[model samples]
Target: MAQNNSAFSDSSVHVDVKDYYGKRLQKTADLKTGACIAPAQPLPAFIRDALKKVHPEVTARYYGCGLVVPECLEGCRILDLGSGSGRDCYMLSSLVGEKGHVTGIDMTEAQLELARKYMDYHMKEFGYKEPNVRFVQGYIEALVEAGLEKNSFDIIISNCVVNLSPDKKKVLEEAYSVLKDGGEVYFSDIYCNGRLTEEIKSHKVLWGECLGGALWWKDLLQLAEQVGFSQPRLVTASIPTIDDKELQDLLGDFKFVSATYRLFKVPRGNTKSCKVMYNGGITGAEDVFQFDCHYTFKANEAVEVDGEAASILTHSRFAEDFTFQPPGGSCEPCNKPKVSVLLHTSDCYDCVVLS
Candidate 1:
């Protein structure tokens, strides 16, 4: 669902992307590549059951590359950019509980229409007196103009949609502007190991399928920093399934991966050496809680973490779920947090300190 014209100077690519997602690719199976598939790891029982509650019609049109669901979503305000057919929005609605709200925005009217059609049904199914989810027609690049307010959302999620925007930086900026200080944008999309050629960038089928429009992994990190989000956490990552021989030949060893990255909007702090304790209280993850691919905190155990990790646990929405203890004999907060583990192939884990 990620389509944009900025990768190339041509405007036709943009038109093709709208046309393909709006009318051409009508279902999940309509996608020819592995861009929209689910994760290799099996989802937990609660999440799987919640997904089953999503109307089949909505899931039929889902084109996301990775799982967008993050931990501790209860009672949080969420925004889903490029929320095609409301698949993830509805699932989030259930996770955030009745008090929480979800807003979905997309430029494609046809997809939005399908998402809107099931609102009443979902509200009734969730046993809510009032509906907590709604779909709006708009582009992801201009969220403020689309009626989204500044510093309003606790979490924002997008599914394979950022690649389709020509102004990827603007999209990130708007996302940052709308997020609360502790809010985070956790999205799943396709990223290539290297930059693509102009010919590849302009390929209509490739662009619409999320291949040709993929951002180089390095470029994505740079964009995050430029927009004031440094040291993005790699939540999950996987190699894309490029089964099409013709497409494979066109790619020519340009490795692509489906990665989910989370960027927090809090002040960039030095990595403080600290320890955290998980109380075994979260709904699904009681015995152990996986913060990202790198760290998992077990119940009643004191887990040592770098400054960035400590900030994530002590300052963000997940703060209440953890108890933080800073490094011994040091009142100075960690300014430059560094992670020594390689959570993914070719990933840079330099934790940046904000000014």
Candidate 2:
């Protein structure tokens, strides 16, 4: 069972979120803090072009913290948790092509109504013979109850919304339950330096703004392990500036950053280190494929990888994109630890997993 916060029940948090996102927030400009704003980074040309095709209204209402698009999305089924305004869903709909499908789930009826209203427009704009995206009204913590089948999605992506949930562990558990073996959950959201006080968690406005219920970055590591997913690989990170004086005062020494992470659901085994080379087939990444912050594989160049990374590349959807040499077959022995401890410093822009 999912545990709720002592200060607020699950139902109360849901109500507060619905009221804030549905009734109070009229547009992206209505956001009081930078926590929900998209990360400031240059996107690839392909992604920029896809964003251009989305309806202006959908883009205008987007409140996500970072870009959730992952590589090799050509024919995969995707699920967007808290798909507000369906911005990421619509963008993904184009990337997934006509043969693939995308599902957007949200708790607020108003957001779902808005997301559903533009289905026809996006399909026509993408030149698809049929619509490839759909929206569901449900909580992220209870995906099975919302009718999403087990092992149904190839990838699940959420943006800036998980922090708003009262039970973060339940959300991860549900995500793991719904993904196929070797599938992944690639998401971006707010993370604080440490666990917050009850007073901070009890603040309605702070909670609604995606500040109050933020997770301590370390807790995410334990949660992923508990839910049977691979250790999270940090993809990108950037500090979010809190401009509100009152909120800043309330959060005296605590700091926040919008970070993206990728966790895989691969078969459990003691994978050995191997040398792998990219074949250069993924659409946008024809020359180099960056698996995470630590490893980047250039086309046709054999790069040695650790055991965990070796497992992810071998078992996930990216398997066909690379050629792997058998472990110990002319490959250097890997001396790194199996578990990489993530270390976050107060002044650093991003956290790194130290092997």
Candidate 3:
């Protein structure tokens, strides 16, 4: 195939991404896992059930980097960026229920066609009366160009697809634009352990698919800030295992980390806070959960009488959401050195500010 030689052409960009992914999608069973870290939780049983009900041909062509929407989404209007073959979108459609909708955007006609063809089958399998998901052919960077409105969706989702875009900043901007004021853009994608070089960005096979042009973590933070969203929150993590024999020579044993992002457009000047007490329940739980999403608190961050006291946790950057007077009239004797004094820092962002 010849190149499109337009001013937009980077000379390095090659091939319709659809053909590249279509082949890769078809051959995923034996495909080498090149530093692609999968999600911690397995795909939801509802989704796996739906996939099984769909004909084998459809499942054979389902290829994606990770499941991005593990949040408790009972009724969210979700927009999936670069939703190839509508796999994730259908899962969201089921989770969001009949009142909700899923919109999938992709640039490849072949992939979009395949996704659209399954609309009836999926709707019936999920026992929905109408098609709750739609597919649009376009780029993630220019989502508004395809008729999306500002501040409309409850949840904006993406799966290992943003790295394929030539204009990721614009993609971040557009994502922030379409989200309702409190809406969040939840996504999972590949990130290099270190910063990426321009040469890696231009790798034809890598960029043509979704592996080569991943963003540096710091750059992603800056873009989220630029887009008027709070800093992204990480909910899960895994490391990618590379398999490219040739690229291995160039990028030797480089680690790839996969993480989920929850970026929100916080309300103006309104800082929120949550009093977190570790119940030793969540992952790698300690005797108490002391770490804030952004920074780790020193031991005794939360005042506990016996490793299990319920006191309002306070941070300098956060307003005490719970207003409780001490057990006495002021600072109570119940505090009897049972808890240590903790100092809070002022360098907190608004995203987690609403903790």
Candidate 4:
């Protein structure tokens, strides 16, 4: 049994998690299950080089399930919830550039200490003018106490940590609160196809290993919608296996997947009535782009999308990267023909008719 000796919280779940990350686990090898590890996915060379530069000590303590990196991060402000050992923070430091900043928050002091230990070293190694990444010892479920300002960060990321939070809904709500209007919450965590029983939830070993704490996929979707993030997009998913037979038996028939999802804090509109066209504007995505699991936009191709989807591309950080058209496929004249022509006067052909 893991004893919670941390000063973070009184809840048994929080105590166990703090103990698990702060004491019981020292390295990835100490984990009893493969749940904390992400499935094999080929990494791009730039990302591979960034991972290679991370301190060995940081990698040794990492226990995440997936690569939750999103694009357009050059000058974006990023926050990592439960950023153990600052592994992702350091990686993001190389990507966010000198003008950008990365902040990591964790409840465990031991992890925070290790993360802060190499701050200067990493800053010098990355060739930055000054330190751009900082670590804060705090709870993911409560960000205000950590002195985080609302509507501040451009992007918030968590890797296999949200499942460990005793208050997942609060964690998400806080995430939404701290993010800028066009910002996004891109994260990777464990999810089960079915709900777990009280018995499983109470198991200390299972919870620490991240299996017993998994949220049902559908419930996670519902929770996201409940908190104003009405549209949650799944980026990647893979089934995870438990090598320990004894623990696997306790898991019973529950199927768990390490899934990465991105929820944007944009206006919730019925994207059902919009048409979109990508102008090959975004640097790397000049030809075609996969907006989510359901939508794809080809360069110069006007694709029909719902109002919500249109709002996602136009109102969010991706707005300048693409052009938007209104519903009914009509850039034609209304009561005022000259007004219609004025609205259509652009190389991108943005004809979104104001209702």
User: Relative to the true structure, how large is the alpha-carbon lDDT of every model?
Assistant: 0.80, 0.86, 0.60, 0.80
Candidate 4 stretches greater than 4 Å from native: 1-8, 270-272, 281-286, 328-355
Candidate maximizing lDDT: 2
lDDT of 4 by residue, 1-355 (tens): 8885643454888889989999999889999988898652456577778888899999899999988678778899999999999999999999999999999999889999999999988988899989999898888888876888999999999999998877789899999999999899999888876789999989999998888889987788789889999467765666676889999888887777787788989878655556666777554455766565556567777777656667777767888776677766663221211122232112111121111
Better of 1 and 2 by lDDT: 2
Error of 3 at 17 (Å): 2.4
| Greater-lDDT candidate between 3 and 4 | 4
Q: Any idea how many clashes model 3 has?
A: 4
* lDDT for each residue of candidate 1 in 1-355, tens digit (9 for 90 to 100): 7886443232565577779998999887888898767572468888888898899999898888888888888899999999989999999999999999999998888899999999998888888899899888777877887888999999999989999887789889999998898898999888887789988888788888898989987888789989998567777677668788888898886877788888887667765768777778787788877666667667777766767767766668888877667666232332322232554324432221000
Q: After superposition, how far is residue 142 of candidate 3 from its true place, in Å?
A: 1.1
TM-score of 1: 0.89
Give the top-scoring candidate (TM-score).
2
Question: Clashes in each model (backbone N, CA, C under 3 Å)?
Answer: 15, 0, 4, 7
User: What would the per-residue lDDT of candidate 3 be over residues 10-62, giving only the tens digit for each residue?
Assistant: 22342445557755455455345543335534665666764565645555556
* Cα TM-score per model: 0.89, 0.91, 0.72, 0.87
Residue 260 alpha-carbon offset, candidate 1, angstroms: 1.2
Residue pairs with backbone overlap in model 3: 35-240, 35-241, 35-242, 278-289
